[model samples]
Target: MMIGPTNLSLTLEQLTGTDAGSVDEAPTNMVRDLIGAWKTPLDQLTGREIGLLISQQDGYPYVLDLVWPMLEDDPLLEAEFYPGDILSSLMRADDTTWRDRPNYKRRLKALYERALRRPDDETEALRESLEP
Candidate 1:
């Protein structure tokens, strides 16, 4: 499932369907590929699809770079009905996942601060998790 750098963009873009209904439950291997790919058209994906992606993640830099921003803008992503607990997945990040990335905590703290700017309960919850 680990696609080469050359195919990464085209795969993610193609996987990020232009039109959407329910999230695609088949072709789930794309989720594994996304774990290493630097960019994904997350904007075109649903809360459910993104949740699947996040669920499979290991707290890589992509969490800070790609996932959190999408959650910030989309109120729907905060809903509890997605395939996984996005908030918990984010909170569960440990040193093993980001040990070499010393900046992760600082960036996460900043994200928490930004989350406070939003009035929604989920974002507030997200803000709380980002710190711990």
Candidate 2:
């Protein structure tokens, strides 16, 4: 079957064993486990898949922490993933205002800035100096 955002969300819910509607109420350990389970190989994902994953309101923190780092390693994938599109999707995902989510704008801005940073082929030792 073709995978879309809802399909991806359902997969995540199944893998993590946390209902999407109740993700916020899930325990810290469960959330941590979900983070680990959500860490799919960046190379295996399509741009649209990546977009859908990050667009998920319930999955935002996991996507930010786990997925953004992977994007840094691949110039093509990083360039193809648009922060604006994700931001728009996030806004539309819920009726709540952006200001209500304390870290949403900060995290989004950070991701946008990271996207603008130069993509490099470097060792872990040299990676720190390359970050914006």
Candidate 3:
């Protein structure tokens, strides 16, 4: 049976180690290119823009580690982000139907929800030991 094109790309990317490790040199270069392409004047950008840039370049998730502490008492933002959320979503992708999962705008939203629901008992039980 023939797999679909989406599966084909996913298979190729997995074989090439794209999903298994840190963003390789090529993806790093591509992110850099996207940043340059999206050169909105600094004055025009918002927190989301900053978060996205840091996320792409660092391969970090939800921009939480990068932006959380600096956000003051903004529960709105904190409630919106969590460490490992984005990364987990990327890692959980089904090899065949990633694109059809949802539109890009809500991808992070779904990821955050899923991450929040993961077993947190072990995490909550060991705060100091878990600090990284």
* RMSD to the hidden true structure, all candidates: 8.5, 13.8, 15.1
**Collision count for each candidate, in order:** 0, 0, 0
Clashing pairs in 3: none
Write one digit per residue (lDDT tens) for candidate 1, span 103-123: 544465554455455566545
Q: For every model shown, what is its TM-score relative to the native structure? A: 0.42, 0.33, 0.23
lDDT, residue 14, model 2: 56
Weakest 10 consecutive residues of candidate 3 by summed lDDT: 3-12
Model 2: ten consecutive residues of lowest lDDT: 1-10
The TM-score measured for candidate 2 stands at 0.33
lDDT of each: 0.46, 0.43, 0.36
lDDT of 1 at 51: 60
Where model 1 places Cα greater than 4 Å from the true spot, the runs are 1-45, 58-64, 71-88, 99-101, 120-132
Alpha-carbon shift of residue 88 in model 3 (angstroms): 12
Q: Could you give the candidate ranking by lDDT, starting with the highest?
A: 1, 2, 3
